[model samples]
Target: MTAPLIGDAVRAPYDLLAWLIGLWSDALAAVGDAFGIGMLDYVFMHHAFLVGGLIAVMAPLVGTFLVHRQMALIGDALAHTAFAGVAVGLFVNSLLGTGISPYVTAVVVAMLAALAIELISEITDAYNDVSMAIVLSTGFALGAVLISLNTGGLAVGINQYLFGNLATVSRENAALLVVLFLVVSIVVTVTYKQLLYVTFDETAARVAGLNVPWYNRLMTTLTAMVVVGAMQIMGVILVAAMLVVPVAAAAQVARGFREALLASVVLAEIAVIVGITLSYRYEATAGGTIVLVAVAVYVGMVLAGKLQSRRDVVEESGAVTGGMDATAGGSAED
Candidate 1:
């Protein structure tokens, strides 16, 4: 039987790396500590503030097409599949004593999963929902098995991925996240016209000679990057909320894709700020708190929509009554 990677002295480099990560995380936490806060407090406040803000900014930029194309569930699928990939990476690193990097493994595996989803959807005449169901169920099951095989305490790691431990993020991880966000931002903005054209009408886009396949793959790859990066902060279980909630909220009022993107970024930023504050006050998970904030925003928007509908009805009724009065006056004059 293979030994545990978590405590393996032979994997000295792994320990060194992990320790370095911990030190950086502490350093970041200490920045907030300067303000008289504890490590956890700092993470809960500043880390969430940073990660949530980044997600809010990017999600809307991509999520406009995702929502328009009815692929919000794709984010959920990728999140869960990435969880399995992380577990597998951990298990393999433990079993092989290779001091493998779980973060790198997660990105590779998740990218493969994204490709698989695309392939299955395109290749089979079968329903996309069925394909998603098969992939999601299998992915979760595999992840559970991998977790069980790990001699080290996989539960805590898994929990961290599922519910998020934003307070414990390392500087390297945060830096990596920032870099990924910048890359995604650049690609999306540079190819904005092509992406929007393809999003609204793929056939037309293709007929116009846009490289639909290449763009599709590029979009999925960008999504994979976002998912992998977010897994560290939001956990796999709730990360999808970041991608979905902002776009949904923006959709309620936004007219065009550009407007929706702007609205999503703004609402997402608000949700993150509100969520972080609430989580700090209630001693809750940062991921869960952020998700809750987004949900609350959506609910408020829905209520607003209902009220607007009622107002429109009243306005229409008054307009009809006024029109009838004008006709009656004209008849009396005749």
Candidate 2:
């Protein structure tokens, strides 16, 4: 078997993305030379930053909706399926002589798994955690079996997929991440209101003339894209954290849904930038480092939220007591 024709179809975009990456690299190299930033001096680090920044944006963009809709686990399910897809791609390449990118296969399998999640929910007349759990398990099991079947040389490379590595970031894969970012951002921007409506209330969205099921499918598909894109740096085990932690942190401080969305993006970007920098400084795993940073951010946000709530309560109590005292004083004067 050969690489899919879709590879040919996307070759032009890949070329364009490569060109953009070159420009970015040149810019980063100049800045690094000026500021003595060692990391920006390397091409792999450039690609790592590029891919990580894009993942930070899209993961939380879709994740806001997922967290609000209580579907955050869907990222995990799709990510596991994507892992299976990676195994499939590697298996094919090993058995045959194709040069297919595992990320490509991961995207396809993950999207299909996304649809399968919706289908399972529909057949059962509700969004079902049990079904999602089954999908997650099955996908992982499939990937494990496939990996065992090709254990001769595949195990050596599998760690990159399982734990992720910054050094493995390649130009072609970065370009693919760019494509996924554009698709996810554009779709979400175009249908922001519809998704917001559905996330809050499917029955209300349907009553207001929206195709709830169709939107559900769209959300899951976007999630699948985000999961695979982030998997490049975050890995299958940690990708879902990118989809939930930032959003949850934002929700702690945001007063409204839109605010939560914007805050999530800002927080995610912070986590990525800080995480990547720290990972480079200490030579830590990118995925684990990023997740740790994100969770730390979440804990900070939670503490801030609690403090704000306490302050509000104190203010309210003082205002009420003052009003009562003023009334009593006025009655005495009367």
Candidate 3:
């Protein structure tokens, strides 16, 4: 009887182990299959990566200066202003029923708005931040009113524009974003030195014949171009996170301007790539996830900075003690 009971107990455990193994195997296979499909769906899959990379690079390119100049809020305003353009585009497309590209129209209108804001600031001699605030509120209010009037067509697009939905990004939008990213990259590269000079010291750059106002306008235009491209990928709502957060994180770690720019780009790229991957798996909005990743990185960087500061203090104390000991030894020998 005892022998029979022990044999039955062993068989029961073996059966249970086999069942668990099969279940785990099936689960892993399902995940693998999904991953395989994602890999094969390159056309759709590549859209996020392409757009993400463009925004990642461009945001940091402009954002480093925006942070340095303490114009982070202006970046926020410009993003909202771009929303009005998107709304107007939706309205026009609905009324005319033509092949109107809302994003292209949005970019053009946003550029004009940026130009107008710059002109207003120059003429009124008002605070630029205040000027940006006025433009942001005005543009968003205009967009909100238009959206209310054309509730059906404009409303759907506006909601997505404000919060962003990367999974819904269309092919046309992706292609246009690619073109804009290339254009912005070339322009920034060509004017890099002038931008850096003006960003550091506008008065000195102006006296040295760097055309400060022109560079300022050029920078704004670049920001607009990036904003338009990013609007599709990250949407107007979270795109500014890419602009400011990565740079802020990078600033904590980097020493020189070039290093900061490179670090910011890397952080931005990491955020987008990882965020989108996780979002795709979890069925979340890619843009929001990307911004969240950026926030996490920023927080981690702050903590790292604090730790580094502590380490530096420890090292400095050790160096001072060693120097004093060496001086005492020399005096004793004398």
Candidate 4:
């Protein structure tokens, strides 16, 4: 319930993000008022959109690298661990009567899990699925145990996180998501080239003197952050879809890495916006609805990609046949 956020600089980021949310919410409220939109009248709707939109952008941004590097499962792994992180936060608060945010604790634990993945990869010289599976299993099991131990009333509250609830998007949580978005965006922007090189070609990056392990750690840690942020709306079970589905859709149509990344962000934003509107109108679960909408988008993208490929093939055949016919006619005239 109490997701306290970061250390020392906490108050400043929270205030800044909260102010930004307030600014956007006010504008949205104005638009709603002008149009008489029912959902926009609610503060929770504003926060839900704020958080969901940010998650939509950053999930694919980070996911592009992960998916290309075949690390899609890392998002899922970290999400499960983040669930455990939520449990840890709740357990500590109840057992010791502290008021720390479960989200803050989730961030801490997920980052540790990120580090553990990196270390295992570095030591074993392979980033395999087995390790991700184990980390995910351990984290979820630990969370289940902790929640059971403190089953007085903690279990009831875990459902929002397990499956996500849009109405639970508090202003504080919205602010926290803003902070995460900034951190992820800034870090990725600054280290874009290095991460790109490391992602596409680790050996060349190492030969060019890039610290591969550091970038790997950074990528996973970012994934952890994105997972937890999106978990507020997408829930742990489906949050990873935001990371993978849009990126996959983009990949189907995009020819280059950056193109795919940009396209993924666009596709994801569309999914989030449409998903939110539909969920609101139909009284459905936001997480599941958004994901279903995303999958539909993905299927559309796949069909388009197939058509594009077929068009290219037909064009090539026509070009070759025309070349052959022209050559035959020229020889006959000679």
Give per-model CA RMSD. 8.3, 5.2, 16.5, 5.1
lDDT of 3: 0.78
Query: Regarding TM-score, does 3 or 4 come out ahead?
Result: 4
Arrange candidates by TM-score, descending.
2, 4, 3, 1
What are the per-residue Cα lDDT tens digits for candidate 2 across 97-140? Answer: 77788888889999999999999988987556877897899899
Question: Any runs in candidate 4 off by more than 4 Å, and if so which?
Answer: 1-9, 316-334
Which stretches of model 1 miss by more than 4 angstroms? 1-44, 306-334
Lowest lDDT 10-residue stretch of candidate 2: 325-334
Q: How close is candidate 3 to the true structure, as a TM-score?
A: 0.82
lDDT of 4 by residue, 1-334 (tens): 4444445667776677778889999988998999999899988999988888899899999999999999999999999999999999999989898888888889999999988888877788765687898889999999999999989789998998899999888888887788899999999999989999999999999999999988989999999999999999999999899999999999999988889999999999999999999999999999999999999999999999999989888788867767756754545332
TM-scores of all models? 0.79, 0.92, 0.82, 0.91
Task: Report the C-alpha lDDT of model 1 over 1-334, residue by residue, as the tens digit.
Answer: 1233234553674555546545645776776567765534544345456666787787767777777777777777777788888888778766776665566677787788878777787788566566667777777888888888774666666677777776656554565566677888999999999999988999999999999877877777777778877777678888888888888987776656788788888988888878877777788888888888898998877777677767878888967668756754545332
Ranking of all candidate structures by their lDDT, best first: 4, 2, 3, 1
Worst 10 residues of 1 by lDDT: 1-10
For candidate 4, what is the total of clashing residue pairs? 3
Between 1 and 2, whose lDDT is larger?
Answer: 2
Give the CA lDDT, 0 to 100, for residue 255 in model 2: 86
